[model samples]
Target chain A: MEEGTASKRAAGRFCSICTQRKPALRRPKTLEQICRECFYAVFEEEIHNVIIKNHLFKAGERIAVGASGGKDSTVLAYVLSELNRRHGYGLDLFLLSVDEGITGYRDDSLETVKRNEIQYGLPLKIVSYMDLYGWTMDEIVKVIGLKNNCTFCGVFRRQALDRGAAFLKADKLVTGHNADDIAETVLLNILRGDIARLSRCAYIMTGEDGPIPRCKPFKYTYEKEIDKYAYFKKLDYFSTECIYSPNAYRGFAREFIKDLERIRPQAILDIIRSGENFRISTTTRMPEQGICERCGYISSQKLCKACVLLEGLNRGLPKLGISRIKAGNDGSGRPDEEPTRRGREVERPILESKPCGTLDF
Target chain B: MHLTLEFGGGLDLLCQSVKIHQVDVAPKDENAKLTMRDLLAWVRSSLIKERPEMFMKGDTVRPGVLVLVNDCDWELCGGIDMELEEKDVVVFISTLHGG
Candidate 1:
C-alpha cells in the first residue's frame, strides 16, 4: 500500500470481517467494515438466504422482475440472474418495464432498461400507458395539471405492471422496493390512516391471492447499500427525478426517513418490523376485493381505479375518479352511469394522503 | 494536489450533470495537510453549482450520500477527518433518489 507517511500508513484499517484487504464499505445492516469482495459475497449471500428462508421461488419457475432502470431494480436484475445461474435455481428471469410516456424522464430511463436487457440477456417486455390506458402521462398531465397527476400515474402504473406480467405469463413478479421504500410507505400509511395498506406494506411478498404473485427480495436491503453496490460495480442505471413528480408530501416523509437513518440506521428496519407486527382489529371494516365490473381488473370498488380514472378522462371530467362523492349518487355510481356534468365543478379533497408512486400498494 | 472526483446516483445533477471531474485542491492552511472536511468545502465552493443541501449538511455529506476515498469507504478512514493525499480518488454517490 502507498503510504503518505509511516504513521498514516499504520492507521490504515483492514476489513473487520475478512481481516485482510482494506475495508471498502460499512454495511448498514451489520455495521461491519468489509472488503469489496466480502461485501459482494455477504450482500449476495444475504439475499440468497432471504430467498431460501422465505421460499420466494420454486424450481423451473418463470419470474419477471419489475425493472425501472433505477439503481435498486438494476441491481436486483443483476443479482437475481447471478444467483439463479450460480445456485442452479432453474428459473427463467425476464425484465418487465412500464413506459409511463413522460417525455424527458421515462423516455430516457427506458433506454437504460433496454441496455440492461442486452447486458443481462433477459427478455424484456415493455407495456406502455398509451396502449393500455389510451393516454400517456404527458397527455394526462396536459389535461389534469400537476396537482393530482401522480394519482393517475400511480394508479395506472400498478395495473400496467400487472398486465405486463400477465402478458409475459410469468409465474411470479418481483419489484425492487427496498427497506427504505417500505419504511416510508409504512409511515405514510400510518399518517393517512390507511390501515389496509399499512398492514400489508411491510410484507416481503404480496398479491398471492391475485392473478400474479409479487415479491420483494430486497425487502430488508438498505438503499444505501444498493447505491454503493451499483457504484462499485459500475452498474449502468438511470437516476433522475420524474418530470411530473412534485411529490411534496412523500418528500417530507422521505426526508424524515433519511434523517432518522442518519441518527440510527437500524430505525429503517425497525419501522418495517413494527409495520409487519401490527395486527388489525377484526371489527374494522376492510375493503372487499373483487373484480372490477368494467375492466375485469382486481379492485375493491365496483370499478377499478384505472377504469374510474379512464372514464373521467374520457368524459372530460378528469376529477370524477378522484373526488369523494356521496355513495350511490348515480344508482350505483359506477363507471357505467354517466357522471353528472353539473357537480363536476365542485372540488373535493383527496381522501388518501398516501404518496402516489410505483411502490404504492 | 490533483484528485479525481466522481459523482453518481443523481449527485451529478448538482454538478451541471457532469459525472466526473479532475481538479486541483489544496489545504486551506499552507503548512497543514488537506483532510476530507477541507476537500468537501472546496467541492462545495468550486464544483457544486446547485442544490448544495442535497450534497452536504452540517459540515459533512447529507444523509444517504456515500463517500469513498481512494476507492475505499471514507467511514473506514475516520469519515470527514480522514487525511487526504495527492492523486487520491474521491467518489460521492447519492442514494436518496427513487428506485
Candidate 2:
C-alpha cells in the first residue's frame, strides 16, 4: 500500500491519528503507513517502560531535562511533562538549556525551548557558552579552528548540564538521546575498539552512579519517532543542525549506520545489542575516574579535558592537553616547549635543577 | 603486499590517506621494526600531535585505534595484543558516546 503518496496535495500529508497536515517529505526509514501521531504514542510508551523498568526516575526526584530546543529534546520535554501529569510521577520537572553560542542555530533553538517551557509549564534554566567559558562557540571555533566543535559542545554541554542540574537542585538529569544515537555510538566505539566506553555505554539508564544520575528516557525511541512526535504534537524545535556539527565524526558514524540500516533494518538494533552483550573485565586499565581540580566533574585525569581546553582557549593557545580537541591539525604548544604540562600543578623534579637562570623560565 | 589502513572520525583528518608498506613491517634493523606500539607512537606524534605517552611494546592500546584483521575487529580475539599478520588491515576509530 502506497499510503499517502497518491494524495493530490502531496506537499502535505495528513497524519491519520492527529489529523494534522504534516509536510510531505520522503517517508521515514520506517514505513509511512504509521502516521506521526501513532509513532509518538509508541515512542512515549517505550520511553515510559524503559524508565520504569530501569527505575530511572526515583521517588521525589527533581529532574532537569536537557533541552537544546531541538526536536529530540523538545519532544522529550513534552513526553516528560505529560508523563509527570498522567502518571503523577511526582517529578519536579525543569528545563535546562545550554546555549552553545552558535549564532543562528543555538539562538533559534533556545527560542523554541523557551516557548516549550511555557507550554509545558516547567521552569527553564538557560546557560550560555559565553557566560561559562569566556568564549562563544563561534569565537572558540575561530580560534581553535573547525576541527573540535563537537568536543567543545560535548564536553562543555556535559559540564553545563551538570551545572544547570545542580542549580536546579535536580536529583536526575534527563537527555534526549534516542536509540539511533546510542546505536551509532555503539558502532563508533566498536569501530574504535574502545572496550571501556563500549562496556559502560551499553546500558539504557546511565549517569547516576557517580553524582547526579543522568538518564535517557528516550533511549529506546528512534530519531524518526522523535521527529514525528514533535511534528504531530506541533512542538516547536530547531530544524537545522549546528553548522559546525556536520564535520563531527559522530555525524559520520550516524550517516554510516543509517546507510547500513537501509541494507538491513536491524543493523542499528543489532549494534546496540552487541554493545549490551559486550562486557569489559575490571582487569583492563580503563580510564580511572578522578575529580577535575578546576571543576569537580569526574574525569580520567586531575584537570578534565574540558578545563584544559578552556585554559588553552582562554590563553589563546587553543591546542593543549588533548589532541582530540584539536583533531591533530596543528601542534599549537608542544609539551616539550612549555615548562608546564597541561594539568601538572608543579614542574617535574627532573626539570627543577636545570632552568634557574633561563630568561623565559 | 599492501594493507589498507582505515581511521575513524577525527583521525581521518590526520591521515586523510595512510599506507604502511609490507616490507616496513619486517625491517632488518630492530630499531626500524614496527610494532602496534610504534604505530601508536607514530599516530601520537604524527597524527595526535600531543605529548607523547611513554608507550612501550606491550602496553594496552589506547582505546582510540581499532586494529582490524581484514574486516574483523581484534576485540573478538585478545585485543591490543592481537599480533599482526602480513597485509592485515588496520582501522583506527575514535571512541564514541551513546548507548
Candidate 3:
C-alpha cells in the first residue's frame, strides 16, 4: 500500500504485494517477490491474523513470551510487542527465559535476552535450572555425560518455562514454534510412533487443559522468514548450536524438512496438515495423566519426568529413568536404591515416556 | 575484483568468527565475468575456516542458507549465475542455526 524501507531494485521488478517499492526478497511460501515494506506488513499482519483467528489473546490479559534470545524468539518478542501496540491489542507482554546453566551456550544467549528486555521495553523474568531443579545443566551433564543430557535439559526447560510463567502469573504462554519446527515435530512423532503427540503437534493452541495454556502464534510462520526479518530489521539475536547435543535427533528431521522446503516450500504446511488429520484408534491404550506424586506436576506415571530424572541424578544412577522401555513391574529397576538426599522422599519407578525433542527452543 | 563479504546468522562461526572480510578475488579467466558460483568456491577455500558443509551442499549453499547480492535475493539476479561487480556487498546468512 505504501513505499518504505531501503529500496532494492532487483531486475527492476516491483513488489508483488504493494507494487510501489522494488522487490527485496522472494517469499518461500508463495514465491512472491516483495519489497521490505510489504514483507513487514504481511509478516506482521499474518501473525496478527493468526492471533485473531485462533483467539490466542484478549485485551488486559498478560501473556509471557518464551524468549531464548535466538532469531525466532527475538523477532517474535519484537513483533508481538509491536503488534500489541500498533493494533491496540491492550495485552500485557513480557519476556520469560530459562537459564539452562550451560557454560557458553546459554550464558551468551541470556545476555541477548536481557538486551531484548531493554530494547523491547518489556519486563523480563528468568528462571534458572539451578534455582528450579537445584542443579544446572552443566552439573547434570557432568554427572550423566553428553549421551542423553538433552533429555534432562529438554524436560527441565519445559518445566522451567511453566514455573517461570506461574511466577509471573501470566494467563498464557507463547513460544516461537514456527511452521518448520511444528512440521519437524510432526515427522518425528510419526517416526517415533508417538500417537499422543502426533495428534496435537499441529494445533495452533495447545495445553489448554493445563494450568497455563500455551500458544504458538508463529505456528504458520517460516524459519527462513524469521531469519530474514531479523536480518532486515537488524534485530540483535544469538545464534549458536548447543555444544552438548549438537547431533540431537531433531536435527536430522529439521534438515530433512528444510530440504523438502527447498524443493517445495508448501511441503512444510502439508506435513502439518497431515499431522492434524491423523486419527488415533479408539482401542489404542493411552497413558493416563495423573499428578506427579513427588513434584505434583502432571505425569502419566507416579512421578513426573523431572522428578524421575532429578532422583536419578541424586542417586548417582543418572541413567535410571532414561530407558524408553516400560519396566512392566513398578519399582523393579534399582529397587534397593534409596534417594541419598530428600529424607522424606520415597523413590518410585517412571513409566516409559519420550523426552521432549530438541528444537533449539 | 574487490568485494565486501559479510557473514551472519551464525555463519561467522564457520569462518574463524570474523564477521566481515574485504578481499580481492580474481576471476578464473580475466576475459570472463565472475559469478556467485565462483565466489562460493573462493569463500569455501579461502574464507570458511571450519565446516564447509554447513555453508554448502554440492555447489550451492545448503537449503537453509540465504544469499543476497547487494541486498537483493540472489535468486532475483539469476541465482548462482549472478554476475559479480566491483565493491559488491554480498551477504551469506545461514538460517539453520539455533533459535
Candidate 4:
C-alpha cells in the first residue's frame, strides 16, 4: 500500500473505470491500476477481434454508417471509428442519418447524432423527408393518415439513405440493426411468406453494382448486450420509439421472438444462422427490375416507387399517395377484392381529389 | 368462381377487373395473387391512365412507391424480382409526404 501511494506522486491522471483522481486507485474493470490508455487498449482488443472475424472493415473503403442516434448506431460508429484508427483499417468513415421529419422522436434523436458527430470525429450528413418532399412526417400522417405513416418513413428513408450514400460515393453503408432486429425481421418475413426476403437477408450484405453494400457489424451482438455495452461505456444515445411507428405487427413479432429467447438465449443467433443456410428459388419469373424513370434508382421496371410517391406529393395529391400500411397484409381475413366495408368511403374523396396520383390500375 | 375485383390502398379500382384465373385456398390462401409484378403493373398502368402527364415520359412507376408482399418489402427481394406465391398477401402503399 505504501509503494502504491508512492506511485500516485509520479502519475497525474485519474482512472476512468473507477472515476477516481487518485493515481494509485486500481481500476477493477481494467483489472489493473491503469489509466485511460490501458483501458482503451483492452476494450478495443475484443472489438478488434469481432471485426476481423466478420471481415467488417475492408481496406481503403469509404464507409458510410447509417446513424440514427440510437444506441445501436452510436455504438457502431464508436467501435468502427476506434477500430479504423487503432488498427489502420484505412476506412474513410462518414456518418449518415436519414431524418424522416418524425415529430418529437426523430428531431430529438438527430440532436444526439449531431453531438455524436463531434464527439466521434466523423463527418455527418442528415437528409430529411421535408427536404425531399416538402412535407414532414407529421404532416404526411395527417394527410395520408396514421394507417400508413410507417410506409412513408421506411420507404422514403430507405431511398434517402441510398441516394445520400450515392451522393457521398460511399462504397458501403453500415446499418445498426443487431441480432434482435435480424431475428424479428426473419419471423416477419416468414409470417408474410416472403421467401425472397427470407432468402437474401444475411448479416453481411455485399455491395452490389447498383445498390450500395450494407453491412451490420453488430449482427452477432444482441440488443441487450448493446444496451449493456452502451451503459458501461457511458455512450450518449437517443432512446425513443419512432412516434408514428405503432407497427403492432412488428411489435408482435418482436415479442414472439423475445419470448422464445427467454427459453433459448441463442434463438436470435439460430435464426440468423438459419437465414444464412436458407436458399431462395430464383427460377420464378421475377419482376423485371429497371432504373427509376425519374431518379434513376433501381426499381422493378423504370420509375422507382419513391419517385412515384414523391411525384404524387408534389402534385398536391397527398391523399392519393401510397402508404406503408398498404405494404403489409393485415390478415384481417378480408381480401383486396372485397368491397370497401362500412364507413370506408371516407378514404375515397381524398384519393379522388388527386387527379394525378389516384390508383386506377 | 371468377370474380371482378378491385384492391384497396394505392391499388384501388382495377381497369375493368380483367378476367384472370383464380386459385382457391382452403379459406386461408385465397388472397395469394399479390406480387411485386402485379403491383408494378398496377402502378404503371394506373399512373398512365390517371396521371397521363406523369407518365408522359414513359410507362413506369416513379420512385417512392412501396409494394410489400406480406410485411417484407418488395424492394429487398430482387427489387421487384420477387415472386408471388399462393395465398400470399400483397400491399401496395405509396410513400408520399404530406403532413
Candidate 5:
C-alpha cells in the first residue's frame, strides 16, 4: 500500500501504438492498447479519413453540425472544426441545434451548446419547435401526454434541423451519429420491418435528394471512444437524459448492441455492414416521395407527419393521427384522411417510439 | 486501502450526484489482495443509492460503462481481475447516456 508499491502495481502496459507511453484505453474497433495521445491521434485521423473517403464535404461548402450539446455533438463540433483547420478542408462550419423545448432538460443542455459555440468559436444557430410548430415539447406533452409526445418531437425536430440548416444557407448538415447509434437503428428497423429505413440507416450520408443533405462523420466511430476522448480532453458536453423518455423502446435495441459489443467488439460495425448490404426486392412497395400539401416538406402522403400531428393538436384531437383506425373515426372526414391514417399506422410506432435523444436527424 | 472513485457521463446521478469520492476500502479477505471485482461490489453497496441495474450487470460494471484505473484503461490490466492499490484513482463512465 505504500506509494512506491502502488505506483509499481498500477503502472499499466505501454501503448501498443506508441510503445513508449502507458496505454490509456483499448480501442474497441482494432482491439489495440493505446496511450491518450495515440488514441487522440488515431481517433481523429480515422474520422478525417472517413470524411475524405466518403467525399462528405467540398471546398468552401457551408456545413452545419447538428450539435445537441451532448458528448457526440460536442465532440463532433470540436473535432470537425479541428479537422477543417488541420486538414484544410475549406469548409465553413456552423453549430446547429434543435430545441425541443423540454424546459429543464433542453434549457440546461442549450447552455452547454452556447458554451460550445464559444469554446469551439463556431457560429451557433438553434431552431425551436415553438418557433416552427408553435408548440414546445412541454405543451405537446401536456396535450398528447407521454404516450406519443416523442413522435411529435422527433418529426418536428427533424424538420427543424433541416429548416435551421437551410436558414444558415448550409449546403450540408453533419450529425454525430456514431457506430453504436447507427447499429441500433439498423436492428430497430429490422425488428419493425421498416425496409426503406433499414436499407439506408447504415449509409454514411443520407437525404441526398433533400435540400440539405445530412452526413454522419462519426458513422464508424465507437461511442466508447467518443466518451473517453471527451473525458480525457475535458470537453464540455451534456449528460442528462430527457426526463420524459424513461422507457423508450430504442433502449432495448441500445442495450442489445451494448451486450453484443461486450461479447464481440466488432459486432457494432458488423450490424451496420449487414444493414448496408441488405437489398430490398424490386417488387416491394416503396413509399413514394412527394411534397406535403400543407407544407412543402418532403413526404410520402398528402400531408407530412408533422402537419397531420399539428392539425390534430390544433383541432383539439391530439390523438387523431396517433391511434389506429377504429369504428369511431371522428367525423372531420377530410378527403386526404385515409392515406394519412395508413401512413401513421406504418410509420408512427417505428419512428416515434425511438428515444428522443437518439433522433439523429 | 485509500482510493479515489470518480463517476461521470450521468453515472453520478445514481450515487446522489456526487462526482467524486475518496474513501478507504479493505479487501474482504485478509490474506487476498483487493481487485476491481471487489471494489465494484463495495461501490455498489456503499455508494450506489438506487438503480443498481444502471451501474452493473452480473458481477461487473454495465456493458457501456468504461473503467479506468490510475488513468489507464482497466482493460489493459486484465479488467475485473486487475489488482487495486492504495491512492489509486478509479473512474467509471457510462457511455449509454444521451448523445
Candidate 6:
C-alpha cells in the first residue's frame, strides 16, 4: 500500500515505537512513524529476533560476513557486530570480500571494505578473480565482451565467497541480502522458470548441505529500512554500480520490485512468502548434488560453474560457461588441477544491488 | 524560503558530487508556500547536473528515492505536497543503491 504518511502528516508527531521523540522515518515494512532512537532499537531487535527464531548462530561460532562495503553489507556488518556485542552472542565475526578485478570500480570499493575492517574492528579477507580464476572481469570483458559477462563474474563470485569463508574457517557466512533482494530473486527465478532456485531463493539460510552455510539476517528486513538505518547511523558505504553489467537482466526485476514496493510495501514480504512456499512437484527432476571435479567446489554438475567458466576463459572459449541453464559437461575437466590456492588481492568492483552482478548460485 | 538540501546514497554524484546545498528558494508566485514539488522542479532545473531521471519521476522523486524533511521522513510530512519553511533541511537519499 502507498504509505499513508499524509494522514499522520506532522513532524511533531511522537514516534510510534517510543512515543517520546519526534518521528524521523516511516518504516516501509510496518508503516510506523518512528524516531531515530526507536528505529535503531527495533531494527536491531527485529534482526535479533529473526536470528533467534531461525537459530542462525551458536555461541562459539565463527561467522564470516560477506562484506562488499556497500550499503547493505556495510550496514549488515555494523548491525551484526552491534547485536553480537549487545546480546552477548559470543560469535567471532569476520569480513569476507570477493575481488572481481574491475579496475576503477572494485579498487575504490575495496578501499571502503578496508576502512570497515577497522571501523567495525572485524578482521577482513578478500579473494580476487585474478587469483581464483586467472582472469579479471576487465580481462574477461575484453575477450567475452559485455554479453553474458555477468554469468562469468556471477559464477566465479559464488565460488570465491565459499572459498574465502572456508579459508577463514568460518562456520557460517552471512550476507547483506534483504527482503527486497529475496523478492527480486523470486521474481527473476520465476520469470526465467528456473524452478531449482525458485524453490529455495526465499530461504533465510542456504548452502547448509555444502561447504559453507550462508545466512541472511536481513531476509525479512526491508531494503529501504536498511538504507535509512545506514543513513541515520552514518555508516560508511560504497554505492557506485558495478562498472561492468550496468544494465543487467536482474535490473528489470529490481526495478519491478521497487515499483511494487511503492504501490504495496507488503508485496516485498508477500513475494518472499510466495517463494518460500512453492512446492516442486515430485515428478520434476532436481539437479543432483555434485562437487566440481576440477576445483572441488560444490556443484550440481560434474564441473562447477566456476570451473566451466574458468576453463572457457583459459581455453579461449568464453561461451563455454555462458549457459543460463545448467552448465553442460561437454568438455573434460582440466588435466592440470591445483589446490584452491591463495588468490592475490589483485583487483575488483561491486555495489547497488547484486554488486558485481552476484546472482544466487 | 531558504532551504538546506542534502543528497546521498549516490544522489550526490548527479550534482557535481556535492552532498549539501544551501539555496534561497523564493516562492514562484508572490508569497505562495513552497512545497517539495516546487523545490524538486527548482533542483532539477538549477542543481541536478546529470541524470535528472534518477532524481525525479514525473513531479516527484523516483519511487525508491526517499525524501526526508528536517530529519523527519517526508512521507510522514505529506511527501511531495509537504510545505517548506525558512531554513528547512530536506534530505534526499536513494535506497535503490545496493550494499
* Local accuracy of candidate 4 as per-residue lDDT tens digits, A1-361: 4344233333444454555533222322222444434444544575578678877667999999999988888888998898888789999999999888777878888999999999999999987766555557776676566776676666677767776787788998888877778877777878887765675665466445555767777677666445444544668877555667654467677666656664566777888888778776668665655555444456663445555565444444443336432322111122233222222222222221211110100
Name the better of 2 and 4 by lDDT.
2
Candidate 2, residues A1-361: lDDT per residue as tens digits?
A: 1233233223344554466744222233343434434565656777788878988886698999988877777878888888878777888999999988888778977888889888889999998766666557877777666887677667777777777787799998888887778887788888888776785566765654666677777766666445545544657665544668757777677666655654565666777788889967768887766665545566666566666666665445666654645332231333433322335333232111111100000
List lDDT for all candidates, in order.
0.83, 0.60, 0.83, 0.57, 0.83, 0.81
Worst 10 residues of 5 chain A by lDDT: A350-359
lDDT of 1 at A12: 72
Comparison by DockQ, 5 against 6, better one: 5
Candidate 2 runs further than 4 Å off = A1-38, A324-361, B1-99
lDDT of 6: 0.81
Stretches of candidate 1 exceeding 4 Å from the true structure: A1-10, A326-360
Candidate 3 CAPRI-style tier:
medium
In model 6, the runs with Cα more than 4 Å from the true position are A1-12, A323-361
Interface RMSD of each: 2.6, 16.3, 4.4, 23.0, 2.0, 4.9
Write model 3 residue lDDT over A1-361, tens digit each, in one string. 0121123225557889788877878898899998888999999999999999989998999999999999999998999999999999999998999999999989999999999999999999999877666677887777778889988888888888888888899999999999999999999998998888886878888778888888899999999889889999999999888889776898899899989998899999999999989998999998777777655667787767776776667656677679864322232333244433334333342222222211223
Task: State model 3's lDDT.
Answer: 0.83
Candidate 3 runs further than 4 Å off: A1-9, A324-361
In model 3, residue pairs whose N, Cα or C atoms come closer than 3 Å (at least 3 residues apart or on different chains), thus clashing, are: none
- On the 0 to 100 scale, the lDDT of residue A252 in model 5 is 91
List TM-scores for all candidates, in order. Answer: 0.91, 0.64, 0.91, 0.60, 0.91, 0.90
Question: After aligning candidate 6 to the native by TM-score, how far in Å is the CA of A129 from where it should be?
Answer: 1.1
Q: Individual DockQ of the candidates?
A: 0.62, 0.01, 0.56, 0.01, 0.67, 0.57
State chain A's TM-score for model 2: 0.79
- Candidate 3's displacement at residue A3, Å, is 18
The second chain of candidate 6 has a TM-score of 0.96
What RMSD value applies to candidate 3? 4.9
Clashing pairs in 2: A201-B99, A208-A213
Which whole-number lDDT from 0 to 100 does residue A288 have in model 5? 84
Error at A100, model 2, angstroms: 1.4
